[model samples]
Target chain A: MSDRGHLKKTAHLAEVPAALEAGPRGAKPRRLVSTRTIVVYGTLFVAAAYYLLPLYVMIVTSLKGMPEIRVGNIFSPPLEITFEPWVKAWSSACTGLNCDGLSRGFWNSVMITVPSTIISIAVASINGYALSNWRFKGADIFFTILIVGAFIPYQVMLYPLVIVLREIGLYGSLAGLVIVHTIFGMPILTLLFRNYFASLPEELFKAARVDGAGFWGIFLKIMVPMSLPIFVVAMILQVTGIWNDFLFGVVFTRPEYYPMTVQLNNIVNSVQGVKEYNVNMAATILTGAFPLLVYFVSGRLFVRGIAAGAVKG
Target chain B: MTGQVTGRATVRAHPGRPSRLTRNLSAKIASIPMMLTAVVVFLGGTLWTVLYSFTSSKLLPRLKFVGLDQYERLWAAPRWLVSIENLAIYGVFSLIFSMVIGFMLAALMDQKIRFENTFRTIFLYPFALSFIVTGLVWQWLLNPEHGIQSVVRAMGWTGFDFNPLYDSSIVIYGILIAALWQGTGLVMCLMLAGLRGIDEDIWKASRVDGIPMWKTYLFVVIPMMRPVFVTTLVIIASGIVRVYDLVVAQTSGGPGIASEVPAKYVYDYMFQAQNLGQGFAASTMMLITVAIIIVPWAYLEFSGGRKRV
Candidate 1:
């Protein structure tokens, strides 16, 4: 109905959407199944399948027994789905010296991720609050360097970090990996928090400052209390990112302390006797399960997190 | 959206801008972590590695300089050459396919369709998984014995042969496939946000002007979304450079090192072979590659002022 002006006056009115021709207020009613609708939905359906295929295949393959996997093609639905592979992968599948399977790595990941996420987010939020409200003389320079330095390939810094860790007596320990994650996680989280804190009502910060609140006073009492959504977003990003990491896990921690991703890689690729495809798929899913759970459960928040995190150009 | 961030990035020299470092002591202390990370870890670590690349360091970093020797040896190695080639192939195709397919999916989703959230969730779920998991899943899917090859053959196409992971010539493409599957969802999400950010008035105006949707998209919409596209380009470019664990879990750089990447080269050289100089050189090259792409973009983004935003 808003397009009525264009329809009455414009020479190219015929080119407007057919819905405008229905001349009704609100939505236009059309055939439920048209050629264009079919094509659009059809392409999306095919794409959704392509995207979902691996997860489907992984689940299907993991459910079948090894004997069945040997005989059946990968795509076929299991004749008899079994939870044996899931149990085996979680408990018994070997990664070299460790026959405790993925549980050890999973716990290791939890240990690394919790501390890393908390420390990184805490540091970044304070940095963000400082930059936004308590702007120091040379603070912007360091923040700028941090953002730009994020693009530098981690390979260049990996060795130097090893040296630093060795000097600090944290090398090959889980603590070292936590520090690595915190350092790497800083740039994005800082930027995320910086923009977020800046967007808050300026009156809020000024009001606190006028009330004679100091730096930590305003931050802990005023800023942190008001930014729960942002904290959740940062946590989502760090937990998933730190959990999915392999290079830092492989480099910073000894084999006995490998994270789930690294250990999953080892168990699957180690050329063990009687290559068990079912167990392999189950272990793979187990490794990916946490982040996937977060992604699904958080839904829109996960999108917001990545959008904020990845759009750091 | 980024306009708002860029606008807020530079807090002006009024109200909040604290005078001198002595003031806001707790703020400075709180910022010590950011400073140490930016200085010690990022800047110092990068410089330290670059300096050490000149030395013939092995098993440990030593300061004995042998200028250009490590770089020379790195370029001469056949494996290094192959890694570079694989990166180029992986980079070019990954960029093109990711942009096009991601945009296409986003455009379709922008058509005001049903189940948009369902479709988006399905597409993005793979991105949540680690590269290690993606690699292992694809390795199983591409296995010649019981994966895609046998499945296709079982459908009466006995001549079917689609084993990219096993064949040296196409093995990188195999990795490329998994990479795209895990990645393009993020790109689509970004592009969809960009599409949504485009004022609806433009679409209405284009319709009134009798412009075809494709023409409007190519000439008007894409050009308008320059910042988003550039940001995506940088993200994908940086990611392509660091594709290590995927190759490791999928093929372990084998089918005879056919799928080696620079990141993997650095890891193996430094850690496994204990050849620190070689790893240093390879990693320096990686840094330079990123700089070549990033520096100019950062310059354009910053120097152009907040006018674009």
Candidate 2:
């Protein structure tokens, strides 16, 4: 009886923080169904159908053979499901000179995305850590500028960045594109990490500091372990963001290094093709697969990341 | 022996110590990249582009001063005017529709429905897709021969005309539909977050006062969610101005450039036509448009907050 009582006390103690975290909107009142319930469910169902329609069409169209697509209804389930389109999309789909398929672009995206995500997150995380923990004169001003700069459209900075890349002899290369991604991604990732680090327990930081840990030492040992969730959130934001990016990829890289989105666009919308609708839909699905996978796997984190971005902005 | 000598040297140097600028040397070093991006890329680049807009350079940027000549030519171009008109139409419709639809969906989600996560997941998955993917999927879906038009015709409507991609007058609306589909989910998420941020007590109080749910959402809830609405508005507005990739994939600004946007105009002129001056001018105009939107909002947000504080 005493052990159970002690366990209950500790559990209640833990829940206090969770309850405070939920603020005044903690509990949702239970209620019975009424007209309002029906109305809400009906509206949500319709909206869900609207949102899911495209994905459904894409899948069904991708599965059907060409003749089936040409004759039958798009809303219908595939009469004859085929994997040939997926195989073709992954291997033999043409985008101008290249018929090696989206594989090349996929590889290019991986090459670009991996390094870019890492570098951007590393730089932004450290910068965020510094800004949040180590306040110096003129830091806030620069932080403000960085935040405001995010609102500036890419067109304003495109040519200038091109010039900078050219001067550094990295223009038209994957390296240049990686640098571009880092620069553009700095604002959001920094904001994310900054807010996260700021929210961490100051006592922990002080405890580590008083134990003779320096800046890098404290960060590497204490802060990094404590903030793994934030790191995951940052990774999700960057992976999906840099993967889905079209502007920077188109701007900073040459044709050989074009990312998946670019190649998909070219293949699907190339003016001189016979317009293979199945292959195009398959290609579209393929291009979206990575981010969609991330979204599905880390669903709530995706929401939290975007919500943090939106709220803070 | 070397460590002892170094320690003695450091102890001797500590009498004077370092300047304030060098106090947090590691932090200052870590922040260089962000500082350079903010100052050089954003501020310096903006100023450079704006300055170059007044020149008459072509093929490559030059310093030949031409005092608003490029802007004059930009205004004279019928394509730019059409782009502006299309943007206006797309912007207004998208802003209205996304907000209304997004808010309605959020309000619905706030009703404590079952399968809330499933519904939200379905709605927001598209937002994960790139604009290119969104554009291509919609393009195929809206294709007259194989898409909704054919399906509707086969449904015995026989005379249904639903091809917006081909019609210049309503082409932008087609893109608007795709934009709303791709974007409203994010807006809904933002709105839902805002809705959740509201205190549950407010709802109870409104219930006690005998207010309808819709009325509570409107007269009570929305007014309280001003910040969220403003943030959503800014996000949607900024996204509207950069509606390039969708147009590129969907229509390629084609059917005689009916759906061309400012960003596309800048890219084509700069890279394809080799007219740097015109591209710079058009880009400057884009910056001005953003400033026009942002300046007043920033004033209201920052200045108003100061008074409250």
Candidate 3:
């Protein structure tokens, strides 16, 4: 199928002499319950158990009454399952002075993620198109800086960004967090889109140009229509990323605007009050639920998104 | 008259040619956001932080040059020392364990196994959750009374004292457990992709040569996956330096400052302690750490790019 035919054919011809000289050798067919098979399956089973342990513990613990959790070990199944912890975690869990629970944080995250994902994706898609197709002089310099900047710890830029946001009167607002997300998301998303757009047939872009289409015309009509899968990949990356963020949400926003992860941390780790492990586990699951849903639903594409990031990174 | 003027202009021009500024006008306009982000946030913000790290700013940032006073204090602080030591331990272990364990998991999965998808999904699901969640779950699991210790004790292993979160010496390991759980799945995925990229002929060739599977993976496959290894190392290293939220949620650097991390150091000094200079100095150190890893990788990538071209 490829240009390797000649090489393979030559190898086979050379192997013919070796086979004639030494005769044929064969590997013993592996039995279904061979030692190797047992080892592989056994190790995998143990790993799966280890990996699944915390989730199992979290679920059963969340369902059990406080008395049972106190008396029994974490791994045991709930003797009597109840949804009270989930209810209380959703509705009345106190995070500091606020008792409204993770729902508020959930809504805030939705507000933050929806806009941030859209705006970041919009800005980055255009950036990628320009880099891949428009080919302006010195564009690579900025792109290089952006990629390098991605590796820098957020602490270096946090205070400076706070200053900029304060000067613009958006420091404590949701919009400020949105802008921060967009800025941070730019590097990876741009790289993702750039690689993708670069891989598209070059003739398609040339034909669009030949038809007298301008930059926006080609992007909106041609690139956008053809890049639905990539856009979805971008969304998957952004949605999960923005949803899971805690640092920026804490550093940039007031408590009222804290994202779910930050709020979940606050609710669980608040120093006052009796520690409710059941409610805490419920809240933790609630906070993680959105990203897990996306990861599950977007299974292969989710893997593809991260794989694209890894291969390029 | 307008038509006559246009005609004269058209006749004078050999062909339609736009100046550089206007040639890609729409593209340039669209790139304004990218330019602003790069120039203002990435470049400008980094420069600003490094510059201000020199001053003895507190509560409010000021231009009173302190001449490394902040770094002097930063180095002298026991808490900072603890943070650095924890980070070193965490970084080394995180790097080694992640590579070894992640590769092993990936290799096992690559064995033409059934239920591969199910195993992969289970391993990676933790990665979907935030570090905060991972920390909390592990914290609950490691609780001295009601968690692993209790369960082990109940199983007649009463001498089991496995409370890493409570002990000052092993608190960082507690955080490491959560971080590895949250991250190894990603490393596995990357390694899996790398494994998939190897040519099928390589495997057949190894088999024909009667090489053991482990030997093939070790001697042949690994050498071919050098680029992926380097990339993964860079990623894991950078992430190691930024380990903050997990520590915060798990132990909050508690039982004293046993689990203090550099990122947490920066945040606490800046926001809580109101010591801007200390925070700036600490953050600058973090930047230096990242640069140490990223610069050489960039050089390699640049060279690799040339070779590919």
Tens-digit lDDT track of model 1 for B165-219: 9899999999999999999999999999999999877977886665778999999
DockQ of 2: 0.48
Clashing residue pairs found in predicted model 3: none
Per-residue CA lDDT of model 2 for A196-237, tens digit only, reads: 899998999889767756678878898889999999998998
TM-score of each: 0.92, 0.92, 0.93
What is the iRMS for every candidate structure? 5.1, 5.9, 4.4
| Candidate topping DockQ | 3
Candidate 3, A219-308: lDDT as tens digits? 989999999999999999889888988899999999889999998999999989899999999998899889999999999999988776
Candidate 3 at residue A135, lDDT? 78
- Superior by lDDT: candidate 1 or candidate 2: 1
CA-lDDT, candidates in order: 0.89, 0.87, 0.88
Off by over 4 Å in 3: A1-28, A310-313, B1-18, B304-309
